[model samples]
Target: MTPLLDLPSNREEAWRWADLGGIAAAAALAPVAAPEAEFLDLPGAKLLFVDGVLDATRSDLGPVTLGAVDPGEHPLGRRASQGWTLRLATDAVAEPVQVVHVATGAENHLAAAIALADDAAAQVIETYVGAGWSNRLARITLGKAARLMRSVRLLQAAGFTSLREEATLGEGASLVTTVLGAGDAGTRIDGAICLAGEGGYAEFGGALLTRDAQRQECAVRVRHAAPNGQSHQLWRAVAADRSVASLAAAVEVARDAQKTDGEQSLRGLLLQRTATVNLKPELEIFADDVKCAHGATVGELDARALFYMQSRGIPKARAQALLTRAFVADAMERIGDETVRAAFVADADAWLERALQSPSRSREGLGEGSR
Candidate 1:
């Protein structure tokens, strides 16, 4: 495979903003090889990627035929970075494919690929451990009538430089993806989803939390190519300290396409002084008689609501945590699972507790007016 580090570095191009080339700064640092997966527990056929290599002993799903795992070898090369893919065999409903990525080293780079066969049904979960010290990339593809409900848990890896995912949905296929990004340093998720088949539908939901200097940026673009296709995106975020989070999403409906129903909402919560957030929702439509809408909001804790809680003797920190969770839980409900969704909410609640109980408020500007 050819090694191409010629990937673009500027954010001027829509595709290059906050790219992973920054990882080049420390790429040569001795990367600790990922240790043996001793006690990890997962519920599906697992494909494990560690230290940029596929673990044979710990990985249950065998390697894909005629495929490359390194991003540097792809046709796009470093320009678009690299991603993994798996083709689910036609009408094959293999076991749930769980992508478990555990990170323990530094200066690491890796990616994973999966494709669900036509009429396949499976669940996928991505768990990232170790400090966010590596740049991880993944790509997921779905075929006709293929259903993959997936969740990505961004463990408290503060050393990671970037995390990006690219996904495509085929004709009459469906994908529901949830992103749980609570802790990480300078993490950016970029996804481009295409609906190429009629009667196809896609849903994208995500929750992001950032504190201190940690930054999380996610951008998703969904294109509706066939008529009667639908897409909806709901994203919520919380930022504190000097942390920053931004989301820009757009859904496009091609000209002459009708019977399309789609909308996007990107909302954020600023929990402390000096926290920053950017939200941009876009909808591009060239066809009339199609339904599409978009909205975004960035604000601090609701003062009136917080005061209401404090009036009931709840400490300020506890009250803020409650409201923040409640605000994010509203979208958490859209995930459509009682057991898993509840567990996810519980995790978010725990994260919010840690976020609130910590030194979230930047001391430098807590005493003065600030955004």
Candidate 2:
């Protein structure tokens, strides 16, 4: 049988390290009714979508306008057949807007388009919950001098999930993104941000935690299309048990993008012998005057530090959790909003607690047991 969508495979460089074949097979099954899940308690203008369908009764709409958006020619548009659209029409929105995508069934599609008017400023949060096969897409466009902060959280129980995001920044605009991903089964996310106008700036930070047999990947491409553009990307991942995590970040500077400044850094921590972590950082600069830097590193926890803490009367599990939490806290701190940052930090702490319950005992190398 022909699949509804032509999913990419290892042949494609973008998906070379991900297990897209398994995800595609799982997505072929019919969707079952989704189970009930608790929603995040946040005070703001919020919108909720259940199984790709909007739930108007539970939503609080204010100055922001909500409508239906056609995915059009987007690569994953077809998959988001029933996603929602959001627009920031006002010059400045004091209260943040939150969007929640909940799935209680299989084969669900989610998509959204966000547009910011000129000189506008807004904060947006996206929360994904429940378990199922999902293909999600988000498109963002920023007008001149606009400022936007986007935060995405994926706390799915267990299922196959894929998300793709594209953003374009106008002159002097600023865009910041913070992501917290925890998927039980498998998850993959790809994003691209283009500095289409001069003096545009972009900053992206992400933290992910995977346990058991979860397979996760995050890939991003940042393009400097105009002169004096700037971009920075930082990603950290923690993989335990037999899980796998991969991070790929690329920055491209065009010939006309002189004086461009771009930097990318990816760091991963392996928690077990059976776990795997892959980090690939690439930089292509066509302009000689541009400044760019990219680097990736993967290693196990510092055993000496862990031993020092343990010798200081800390339990083994507690010591491990403390060290692991510090590893990923830098990304969480990058979130600008005080409330949002607190929420994400709390979630990370909870994940660390759960991981410490079944701490990794393998100490094959990487200075483990050297003390």
Candidate 3:
């Protein structure tokens, strides 16, 4: 039997800004049946999990090794035993792999571990949905010279969700992660990546849209423990209707990690008077020969640009949507996969449409403070 760990509360520094109390309350709700899988047609293999149980018939996994068993870690890893297991071997998968998590009115706990063999390369897409609380943990390891690209999309409409990911990179290995999130009552994501071997590289970026009292937060930490490691992180958030969005990141370069290069940027857009956003980007460098930079900004739309568009005969609603889409595209355009990028942008467009429904705020008297 799997045992639950002592869940961390808001008192912890890592979870200080999260809505842990609301998440716990939602998790205690009565359990309901799992929802049917909502398919996304793509040129890739599929792995389906409903309510923490893997569905073999719907899963068309390829050469990758997959099963459900003990992850051999702690309480969170133990959840993998109750959910799905995926491992990559020698071959480079031609198509991306899709993993879907669907839930209903219950607390769903899921875990996934991806281990890449030497010289292997693969693409993976993960999607989460439904109206139930979820706790998901993923741990990954990259062998020498391996490459992995992962994309995540969260459209949980309403519920409490927490996602935690930890990864270690090997010599010359590379890992890229892109995320798109929206439509959740409360969401928290924590990510940690370690450049454990020399010449490793990691890139992390995401775009989020929140509205109508939703609370969304993402915190990521990247550590360089070896020489010649490199990493870059970029994130954008748009909030409206009393919603709150936050992005926090910490980059650390060890004393021995000479020649490390790291960069981080975070930006937020406020579409309503009551909307709020918080951004924190930090860099800790003990190495003398390293280049690291970090910055953050929060503001509203450009009134001048909006007025020019309006003067050009573009409808106010359409102009707002177009500008909002372009704001998020700054980060979304970094995605390598065209299909995944387009899908994420489409979701962002949907969000912008909803955001435009709110009454437009006047720029008068507010000055620079209006934003």
How many clashing pairs per prediction, in order? 16, 1, 0
Worst-scoring 10-residue span by lDDT in model 3:
361-370
TM-score between model 1 and native: 0.83
For model 1, residues 1-371, the per-residue Cα lDDT tens digits are 11343444445444443434434432433445454443224454666666545677867763343245545433222332433455667876654555666665554566666687788876666666554356666676778888888777776454554565666777788888888887554566777778877878888878888877777777788888888888989999888788878888889898855888898989988876578787878888988889888888877776777778879999777777787888888666755545557657877887787777665353432222323
Q: Residue 68 in model 2: shift from native, Å?
A: 3.5
Task: TM-score winner between 1 and 2, please give it.
Answer: 2
What tens digits encode model 2's per-residue C-alpha lDDT throughout 324-364? 88989887777887878887888888877776575235333
Ranked candidates, highest TM-score first: 2, 3, 1
Deviating ranges (above 4 Å) for candidate 3: 1-6, 30-36, 64-80, 359-370
Best by TM-score: 2
- Candidate 3 residue-wise lDDT at 288: 100
